[model samples]
Target: MTATALPRLCVVIPCFNEAANVAPMVARLDATLAGIAWEAIFVDDDSPDGTSVAVRAIAVQDSRIRCLKRIGRRGLASACIEGMLATSAPYLAVIDGDLQHDETLLPRMLEALEGGLAEIVIGSRNIEGGDKQGGLTAARQMISDTGAALANAALPMRVSDPMSGFFALPRDLLEEIAPRLTGTGFKILLDILLSAKRPLRSLEIPYSFRARVAGESKLDAAVLLEFAGLLADKALGGVVPLRFLSFAAVGAIGLLVHLAVLGLLHGLGGVGFNAAQWSATLIAMTVNFLLNNRITYRDRRLRGPALLRGLVLFYLVCGLGAAANIGIANLLLRDGVLAWGLAGAAGAALTVVWNYAVSATLVWRAK
Candidate 1:
């Protein structure tokens, strides 16, 4: 690739704390994309492990290597979106920063697009020639298989590996559907397939999923929850916001926490109704705050001093909601309008709307 020649294919790698893999990833791409004009863009989410620094060190020696360091923002889907938009390359591919995805498939994916075989090509492990045994552990494999099944049920087009992160598509098609993307979750490929206004022609290329040599795997139980949220967001056609759904789900869990604590204190310990209810409400509120930080506003998640400030602000913002909760439950209990369990649930339900509205605007509003 010459400095003056523009790349026909641009590979966007979204990274976080993958400093150890950046150099190896670049070298692999250089070796595989021999005669193709390709450039690599490493979009780092302000990784604490100095991922951006590593990319720059290589970029200084190779013009085809570049970096887009993002601070105060995170999420693989959004990172890939930003990196793809930053380039003028006609075709775009999204691969993991980890060495798991096959870099050699880039040329074939480009050929498929250029030959008009499909609008998008995915690197699939569920296909005949593909293998996931080398990379995913037993539990991780189970999660992937389950997620893909659920995703296929909701997707417009059937994909063997809807959860696969490795895929390539024309830049224009991406731009056409970019507005419809949720830009909030780990499964961007699923988001793309579901968001399209019309059915997209897609092909799957078989490849072995490689195990990680360095850095921790990001997959966890929380990721599955986020994946469900993405599907729910698409199903609703974006009429209801995704964050509100996540916030409401957390509120539902908080309600259970409230009841459990109330049952323990008032039912078993013989504590006064008023005192028990107040304690339960406070405890549930704290649980809701923590869960919301980790999931609902994850892209804008708080950390360090910011996390402390956010927690305090969350309590303050929900104070009115909590007050309403206590007042309503007391009224129902005093008037004997309902049983204690029913009364408590009624009050908690009222606060969901207030807390979601206020907390979103004040506590986790975009920084």
Candidate 2:
């Protein structure tokens, strides 16, 4: 194939359970970019709804459409990073997998980047002629606006819509900032803008955010937490992932659940101390697994038989981790290595790391 015919743009759609939107998005892109040499990549986090399957089916016939199924990991922003890194195209764009962002604006974004008019092109809902009436409800818009305000205050350069997920930039610029990206949440455009060493020339293109015809929206309370965590990560130099912070918070709650269950069984019901202890341990483990599945690993949640299997595996891993915790604590105390407080803290810290690693790699591993 001639150089002119080679694909010059890669569109990354970070997706999760967006099977219904795959074909429609591909069709819309094909119709919208008639002369542009572009390829659409659906970066799926091993969606249980067979989203990757749908994209692969289309990819079999259409070379311009591709699927990048990521296993054993999840996160929309991370998926976008992986998708962008997999492409050799000179220009890259990120759009919502639900087809909420107008596909027609993609050509304009490409034109701005390819024509040397801008280094970054954002599809803004706050810009003039931008359609804010369609996709986002009042409450959602408020949340977005609040996030944008917080992001702008910390950003090196001012941007009207830093919360926007839809944006385009040169592959070279992306490569330069890729190492600095937090890849933690949904606001990748903000991460890039903040990661840049110097100011970026940005252009906002007005486009109506279309309502989804199929599939549920991914926005939720967790998104808010993730966004907060991203800000923290950027501020703290990426010392910790927001998901890990969420996991630790859930663990703290599980400790309360353990105490409550133990108190209820042993104190109120007059159950044997041994019986109550075992019951509370098991119950707390169960509670932690459920919460982690829902909050920490929401995108890669196991379903059907996988869910049951994961629960059993989680119990085993956590149970073993608990045993290790006690053993290490006892060893430290008996050896007079440190005070009881430090020993116990070290033991708990080790257990938390062990549980998180095992749970992610073994229990809730992607199919």
Top candidate (lDDT): 1
What tens-digit string does per-residue lDDT give for candidate 2 at 14-85? 999999999989999999999888998999988899999999999999989989998877777889898999
TM-score of each: 0.91, 0.82
Q: Which candidate is the best by TM-score?
A: 1
Worst 10 residues of 1 by lDDT: 1-10
Error of 2 at 120 (Å): 1.0
Q: How does candidate 2 score on lDDT?
A: 0.88
Q: CA lDDT of each candidate? A: 0.91, 0.88
Writing each residue's lDDT as its tens digit, candidate 1 over 116-203 gives 9999999999999999898988988898999999988887788999999999999999999999898887888988898887778999
